[model samples]
Target: MNSSESNENVKEASSIEAIEDEDPTVLESSTSETEVDAANTSSSATEGKVRKINTETFIAEIFDYKANPTKWVYKGSKPAIIDFYATWCGPCKRVAPIMDELAEKYKGQVNFYKIDTDQEKELSGSVFGIRSIPSILYIPLDGQPMMSTGLSAKDEYINQIEVNLLKK
Candidate 1:
């Protein structure tokens, strides 16, 4: 690749590193309500609140990585934002509220799910290569899922959903 492209790649990677001291509290953001109900009282795909998902649910709901080891086949009605986080992570804790707000805003339009990295060893390190605490997976209905490591602005996440998942 050319220097400019290489530099861009580096910058993107740098921004998505495993944030060790990122203060999610330092950032500001807003919320909404409509299209999808991500996580609610139940882990229904229709809508609700941000909910936690495990390896079994992931395989059954998201992608059967073990079934199709060579390919990425997502099984969901709408786009999803999978927050792979740990309870001990400060940044993860900060991100929790944002995910919840987004879950309500994008209700019925998107699915917001969280995975505990500490609990799901196979899913985190083996399946998703989660080198960081807050490695988020943005999965579109008809496209390959993308991973963004580390902490970032809530607006950035919104942009990713709009551009990559919502195709807006």
Candidate 2:
């Protein structure tokens, strides 16, 4: 990456870190930190589920990136997939069910999250540089995250999960 790109990445990293420092729940996918934690602890109660994420949780839970912005450092013990989407987007709607299914199918093997682009404009636009709806971010346990936009086939998503997230 060029200096400018690198600088942008640094800036994004710092911004996300700052968001975490500000309000932790601001990044939570649903309700608040407690609720999400509850869901995680008892994820079996809800099969094939996808959690919501914000700037704060994204940094703290997904990747403690602020701790080290220069490299890929995932925070969670399990792999995760972040869905960056807008509610009004048709393609996003199409991808929603697929995400839910994937979340359920992967369940204990992987953590699934959804980030509303409209609600999290800063993280979506500035931090993640999201320009479209249904931008999926695949985060492995030990590697840089990869982003894919638009609606993709279920099999494609499964491939990514198996290859990137599961590493199998």
Best by TM-score: 1
Predicted candidate 2 versus true structure: per-residue lDDT over 64-154, tens digit per residue: 5457665667777788888877656678789989999988788789888888776767777666666555677777787667776667788
Instruction: Give all candidate RMSDs, comma-separated.
Output: 8.9, 8.9
lDDT of 1 by residue, 1-168 (tens): 233332221122111133233323222222312223232335554375777777788888878877888677778888999887776677888888888888888888888888877677778767765666577777889857766666667777777777767887
Count of clashes, each model: 15, 4
Best by lDDT: 1
lDDT of 1: 0.67
- The lDDT of each candidate is 0.67, 0.66
